[model samples]
Each structure stands twice: as structure tokens, then as C-alpha cells.
Target: MRSVEEHQAVVDGLLPAMPAETVPLAEAHGRVLARDVVAQVPLPGFDNSAMDGYAGRWAELAAADGSPVRLPVAEDIPAGRTDVVPLAPGTVHRIMTGAPLPPGADVVVPVELTDAGTEVVEIRARPPIGSHLRAAGEDIAAGTMALSAGAPLAAAQLGLAAAVGVTELSVRSRPRVLILSTGSELVAPGRPLARGQIYESNSVLLAAAVEEAGGIPRRLHFVPDDVDQFLATVRAELAGADLLVTSGGVSAGAYEVVKDAFATLGTVEFGKVAMQPGGPQGAGTVDGVPVVTLPGNPVSAFVSFEVFVRPALRRALGHASPHRLRAPARLTSSLRSPAGRRQFLRGRYDAGEVSQVGGPGSHLVAHLARANCLVVVPEDVTELPAGAAVDVVLIEGALQ
Candidate 1:
């Protein structure tokens, strides 16, 4: 049996680095930047107000000592006003938030500090000079790097790009993954199941996983356990697919159509890894497209994807950190694992403590859904008592 690390390396090496493509800023969210994005113009391109108030010279307000100083409101300035004139020597301008500051105005007295008026206003208090003014180039300067290469674009980053007049961004292209699941006893959900047939769910699970990992997923209908038919179905859909992912049929069973069909081609290899719930694995090429075969059980398929395929896809997409965040957590209860295989148990992690969610069963999809983390038990250890510190791979909110 191959160790888990060996199989991980083999699977990760299957796909080459993806090339970059220019996409509209709207579509670039969740994609990794291929090149540094520079600011086309400085943030806050013009001096603007940070508050709704009156703009005037600080000297006029301070001349009143502790008494209220009244000034004529020369003009009312709202946001988006382009035809702004400098403030007269002794008059003030009524300004709203984000409105450009007039040339001679050096301070803003918040509306709350002055009598709210349109034609004339009374300033009750004096504020420091240059207060409540957003200076041009204060946030970021023009021609400087706004976002660096290898950064993942999100809402804030996209907003910044838009602020700097960036309409398009160069990002790593998402890999197109063709996904399928195999089994003779499998039937689609929402259909009545016969005595022996069960609902097929691996395809849905793996397809969502692929998309969550930043790969484009095209899910093929679940194929039956016939070697010739399986080979034909896969080869037909292999066009334009960068990677092929299938679940089931690679295990040691009599009618393992995936292993049987791919073995005949002499390109794909099948083996077992020293990991519980997802030991059976395969990786190779079919018609020049990379393929990764995972065990059919829903939990197993999900775990295998998290362990192997997710990182590989993220790496191809140029993500700097492709793996899940792992941290040490104290166990709330005892657990046992097989002697020679590493175990990844569904777990709930909170505040430095992790508790097992359910028994280590591959078919317990409900338990898997309730888990926010995976409690990893190494191969050398068989039993871990309560309060023992073990590593946990955090999953909740980790995709971002």
C-alpha cells in the first residue's frame, strides 16, 4: 500500500500550472491574480469631505473666541458636483459627505457643531485645521501596486480595483474538470429505488467540491459498472477537459469497472493509500487529460477531494495557500484508529477544542455535514485519550 503522502504527491503532480487570462472585474472574484495590479489613479482622486458639514477657513471660526460665529453660506455642495468654486474669503460652503472640498477651505465643521442652515450657518465650535478632509493620494498613490500577484481577488480587492479605474484583471484560468461517478446499484435521486438500488450522490458531492476548489465542473451522468461502456463514456467527454475526476470502482471488488477499464489502457494506475475512509485511489491520464479516481462513499469522496484534488486545483489556479488551515486542538473525548492507516474523523472544532462528530464511518454523510473540521490521527497511534492534543484541519469558512 502506498503511504498517504506518496499518493498525495502523485496526484498533485498530475496537472500542470494553468495559464492566465484577462477577465472582467466582475468575473475575477475568487480568482488568483497572475500579475500585479497597479493603480491607474490615486485613491480619492480629488480632495473630498469625510463628513456632512460646513467648509470654511479655520481662522474665521476661531476669531469668535468662545461665542458662536455666523457666516453666510455661499453655495450648497452635494456629492458629484463637478463645477465647484473656491470659498469666498469670509463665506462658508454647505457640504455633504464625499463632496469635493473647495480650494480655499482648509477645515470642515460637522453639521452637528453648526446651526443646520442653507443660506446662513452659525458655527458653535472651532475645529482643528485640515480636520474631516480626505486628501488626494492619502489612501493609495497612482502608479503604485494596488494588489500583488498571487493574491486572491475578493470583494474588497475588486472594489479597490474598481476605485483605481481597473475594469479588467489578469487572473489564473480555472481548470475545466469533468466529473463522473460509477456503480451498477446506483440510481439518481428523486427516483424510486428498487430493492437493491441506492441513490447516487458522489457525482453531486464531487462536482460541488471541484467548483469550491476554483475549478469549473462539468458533471457527467453516473455510468454503470460495465468496463467497455465506462471507457466509451469517459473518452467521449474528454475533449476540452483539463482533468477528469471519478468516484467509485477503484476499490478491490469483483466488478471494478473503473480499475478494469483504465488498466487495459495501461496508462492509469490503481492502488491503496494508508488512510481510512478513502484508501482506494487512482491517478493517471486518459487521452492526454489528467484523471483522479476516488472511493465512492460520500464521506470518502469528500475527504479524498479535500486531501488531494482541492489542493491540486488551487495550485493550478495559482493560489499561494492551497491547503486547508491546520491547527492543534485539544480532544474532548477518546478515539481509536486502525493500526496501519491514518484516520480523518469528522469533528466539531471550537475555541481550541475538537470533539468527534460521529463514528468513523465512510457512509455517514449527515455526520460529515455537521462537521466543521477533520481530526487527524497519525498511522503510528492507535488510541488517543481525552485532553490529548491533535491536529485539526479547519474547514468552515476556509474557502475564502
Candidate 2:
């Protein structure tokens, strides 16, 4: 009988943020940095024209009304060449895009405003001191922290790292995960299923979830409902993984192989939480390595990943803020939950409000597949009416 936040606290205690490893910029995507990434040098390095335009002092724009200010074209400054000196007095510089501004010039006139009067074009408008010119450090400054430790190494973050002279960065190492599924009536996918056997989909789903959360799922270890065999298989898989995650066999049935096997191994602590579908949860260390065992239902398994395992992995990999964003939306239909335990209802949401995509039962798989959101109905007094404001677990992209 714990609140959602309380269970979250228990899960959080299982993993702590750790330092990062140095990885090549290309491979560092989606990893968290170990430390702050600061700029080694200013971007743009110098004042350069933002456009292919003429360079001149502001005084030239006012003088354009008079007889053409046909000044001598002092130095031709093209893009990528820094050898040209500043504009000389009473002289103009033919500047191209990305070309540095001469030391003496404080303005730029685009190439379109020109005449065939002489080799030197007539000046028209006066560009301000910083107009069109990208001054040094305008984008980024030297020695400034661009990416902080525990922040995700996203595409934009990587680009910023490169701008700051970071060829490789110290990032969090992806945890090696071993996914094991237990059941007597489970058959692998793409095969002929028997009368009592169902396709084993939890391993595939769990593996993908592991990869998406930045962990490396070694492979699936499927164990039939034989207690001795399950125990033996789990030991063999644990030897190679940093952490182990298993689905099924933790429930209260006599055939619950997982619950019985771990009763003496000192690895799993079995308990039925005050929640639906996913109420059964267990976690502990087997031979010094961390392991979390989830309920068998497909919806329960996926929800367990979102609620418990994913955040744990993220925290272990050095994520500062690892929880999903709770987006508030109006419920389009009524919902009722068990009086005591909290519920995670699978749902689909559109622009403004949300409608239940699947039944509230944890056993419903078709509805779970169509859902992209989890409508969080708290343990408090229970009816969530249509158009009611409820907190929704948004599995969608970050709310930009």
C-alpha cells in the first residue's frame, strides 16, 4: 500500500548516477556526459559577413546620395581567408559571405547595391557596427560550459560539443541488461503455437525497451515453468550481465517458478504491491548483481519498464532528470480504479484531450498495443469523469 511517488522512491534507491566514459562524438549520441563540456574557443573566431555584401563604414550610406563615393577597392576579402587587413581610410573592401571584417570597417553593404560606374561600386546603405557581421563568440564563448554532466547527449548537444572542440566526450557507459521471460505456455515468435502456448512477446518488447533507454540488452533468456530449470538458467545468464530483468513466475500461483526459485537464493524479494495488473513486483541482487522481476502480463511488463526499470537504468547511466513528463489532459471517458491500489491505464491522446485506447484491465493486449499514453488514476477516491483533468504519463516526445 504505497503511493506512486513512494514506489518511485524505492526504485530510485536502487540506482545512483555515475560518472561517464570517454566516447567518440559519433557514438556518444543518447549518452549522458560525465562532466560539463565547455567551449575551448569562440565560434566564428572573428567578425565575418553574414551575407555576400560590400564592407564599409556607416558614413558611406549617407554619402551615397551625393556623387558616387567611388572609393578604391582596397582588399578583396572572400570566405575562409583571414589574411586581408581592415578597411583603409576612404577605401572599400569587396566582402563575401563568411569573410572577416577589416579592422577599420564597421559596416557591410550587400553586393546587390552596386553600379558599373567604376571598379569601386557606389555605396548605398550604411550597415550598423554588428549588422550582418557574426562577431567572435557570438554563438559560443571560450571556456564556457556548453553541456553539463547528467544531460543527454542529443544531436544538438553533440553539435555544440563539436563547436567547442570536443572530439570525444566522457559519457555514461550503457548498462548491460539480460532479459529473461518465464512461462510454461510460451512459444517464440514466428513459429507454430500449440493449443496452450502463446507467442513469447515480452522478451522482444523488453529488449527493445532496454535499447531505447540506452542499455545494451544482451539477449532473451526464456525459462519454462520448472523451478529448478529456471533457477539454473537465471544463474547462467547473470554471470554475463550487469543487471538482470525477468517477467512472469513471481505471481502467487503454485506454478510460479520464479517466486519459488528465488525464495532461498537471496536474490528476489517477492511481494504483491497495492496496484493492478502490475501489483506484483520484486527486486534484489543475485550474486552481487542487481535484478528486477516484473509481472507476466504484457501490459504489466511494459508498464513496469516505464515505471521502474527505465528510470533505474537512466539513473544508473547518469541522467539527472529521468522521470517521464506528466502531461495533463481532459479525459474523454469515465474511468474507475480499484479502491486501494493505483492504476496505469493505457490510452491514446490527441491535440487537446484523451480517450481510453484500451480497456483498463491489465490483461488486455490489443488495447495496450494501440495506446501511447498511460492515464494515471491515483489511489484516492476513484471516479475520473469525462472532461476531468487528470495527470497523464506522456510517452511521447518532449513537450517542446
Candidate 3:
């Protein structure tokens, strides 16, 4: 059996780097930037007022000597207004917040400091020069790098891009993944189950996981234990797909449809890894799209995705940190694992303690759903006592 790192290396070697595409800024949120975004225009665009007040020459206002200095308002300026006229030498201009400051104006006095006059304003206090003013390019300069490549466009980043007059962006194209779940005994949800039928869920589970990993997922109907049908289905879905992910039928079972269909294709290699609950794994390509085949069990399929496929998707989409957040926590109970296989047990971590959520069974989907983390046990050690420090991969939000 292969080690986890060896299998991961095989899987990572198969994925091609995603190409960049141009997208409107409205659609760029959550997408990774493909190139450094240079500022098209300086932030604030021009010298503007940071508050609603009077824009005047600071030397004229200071000449009043702590008394109320009345001056005729030269012009009224509101935000987004063009046709701004220069401020008269001795008069003040009524300006609104974000309005462009008139030429020759050296300072702004907030309306609260005066009598809030519109025609003839009373400046009760003398503000410092350049007070309440936003200079051009103060926050960001034109032609300077605003955002770097490989950074995810979050809300603040998007707002900054818009502030710099950016209407579109170059970003990594989201990978399109084709998902298939294969099993003869599998039945779709909301349908009647016969004697030995179980509702197929791995496709939906994996599809959601793909979306969370920043890939677009297209789920195909479940393929039964027939080699011809499986091959036909794969061929049909190969068009326009960047990656292929299949759950089930790769194990050493009598009716392993995926293995029988793809074993002859020189691109795919089927094998086991030194990991519990997700030992059976496969990685290769069909046609030109990369293919990853996970084990049949639900928990095993999900764990395989978290360990291998999710990081590949993130890396292809230009993410820098492409793995789950891992931290160490003290074990709440004793646990045991096989001597040679590394164990990823379903667990719930809180504060500094981690407790096993369910027994080490691959079929326990309920327990897996309740788990927010995977308690990692190394292959070298078989037993862990309570209070032992264990490494855990956090699948949900951070432990509180």
C-alpha cells in the first residue's frame, strides 16, 4: 500500500494549472485574481471634502481671531457634482462630504463648528490647514499595485477594486468537475428502496464539497455494476469537464464497475493507501480530464475528498493555502487504530479537547455529519491515552 503523501503526489501531478479569464467585477467575488490589479485611477479620484462643512482659505479664517467670521458663500458643492468653481480669496464655499474640493481652498471647517449657514456662513473655530480634506491618491495611487495575484476577492477587496474605478478583473477560471457515483445497490433519494438498496448520496455530498472548494460540480446519475454502461457514461461526460470524480466501485469487490471499465486505460492506476476508512483510492485521467476515484463507503468518500481532491481544486483555482486548517488538541478519551494505517476518526473538537464522535466505521454517515473535525492518529502509534495531544483537521469553523 502507498503512503498518504505518495498518493497525494500522484494526484497532484495529474492536475493542470487553470488558465485565466476576464470577468466583470460583479462576478469576481470569491474568485482568485489571476494578475496583479493595478490602480486605474487614484482612490478618491481627486481632492475632496471628508465632511459637510465650509471650504475656505485657512489664512483668511484664522484672521478672525476666535470671533465669528462671516463670509458670503461663493458656491454650493454636493457629492458627485462637476463644474466646480475655485473658491474666492476671502469667501467660503458650502461643501458636502465626498464633494470635490474647489481650487484655491486650503482647509474645511465642519458645519458643527459654525452656525450651519448656507448663504453667509459663520466660522466660529479656525481649523488647521488641510483639515477635513481627502487628497487625491492618499489611500492608493494611480498605476500602483492595488491587489496581488492569487488573492481571493473578498468583500473588502471587491470594494477597493471598485473604489479605484475597476469595472472588470482577470481571475482564474473556476474548474468544472464531473461527479459520478457508482453502485448496483444504490438508489436515488426520494425513491422506494428494494430489499438490498441504499439511497445514493455520495454524488450530492461530493458536489457540495466541490463547490466549497471553489469548483463547479456537475453530478451524473448513478452507474450500475456494468463496465459498458460505465464507460459510455464517462465518455459522454468527458466533454467540457476539467476533472472527473467518482465514488464507489474501485475496491477489490466482485462487481467493481469503475475499476473494470478504466483498468485497461493506461492513464488510470488503482491502489490502496496506508490510511484507515479511505485506503482504497485511484488517480488518473480519462481522455484529457483528470480522474479521481474514491472508495464506496460514504464516510470514506467524504474523507478522501477532504484529504486529496479539495486541495487539488483549490490549487488549480490559484489559492495559496490549499488545505484544511489543522491544530493540536488534547484527546478526551482513549483510542486505538491499526498498526500500519494512519487513522482519521470523526471527531468534535471544543476548547482544547477533542473527542471521538463515532466508532471507526466507514458506513456511519450520521456520525460523520455530527463531526466538525478529523482526529488524526499517526501510522506509527496504535494506541492513544486520554489527555494525549492529537493533531486534528478542522472541517468547520474554528474551535470555540
How many pairs collide in each candidate, listed in order?
Answer: 0, 5, 0
lDDT of 1 by residue, 175-218 (tens): 99999988888898999999999999888888888888889999
TM-score of each: 0.92, 0.92, 0.85
Rank by TM-score (best first)? 2, 1, 3
Best by lDDT: 1
The TM-score of candidate 2 is: 0.92
Worst lDDT run of 10 residues, candidate 1, spans: 391-400
Clashing pairs in 2: 20-171, 21-171, 54-109, 86-102, 86-103
Encode model 3's per-residue lDDT on 50-124: one tens digit a residue: 999999999998755668899999899999999999988889999999999999998999999889988898889
lDDT of each: 0.92, 0.79, 0.91
> What shift in Å separates residue 209 of candidate 3 from its native position after superposition?
1.6
RMSD of candidate 3 to the truth, in angstroms, is 3.4
lDDT per residue as tens, model 2, 323-378: 88778899888888778877788878777688887677777877877777888877
Q: After superposition, how far is residue 126 of candidate 2 from its true place, in Å?
A: 3.7
Model 3 TM-score, 2 decimals: 0.85
Which candidate would rank higher by lDDT, 1 or 2? Answer: 1
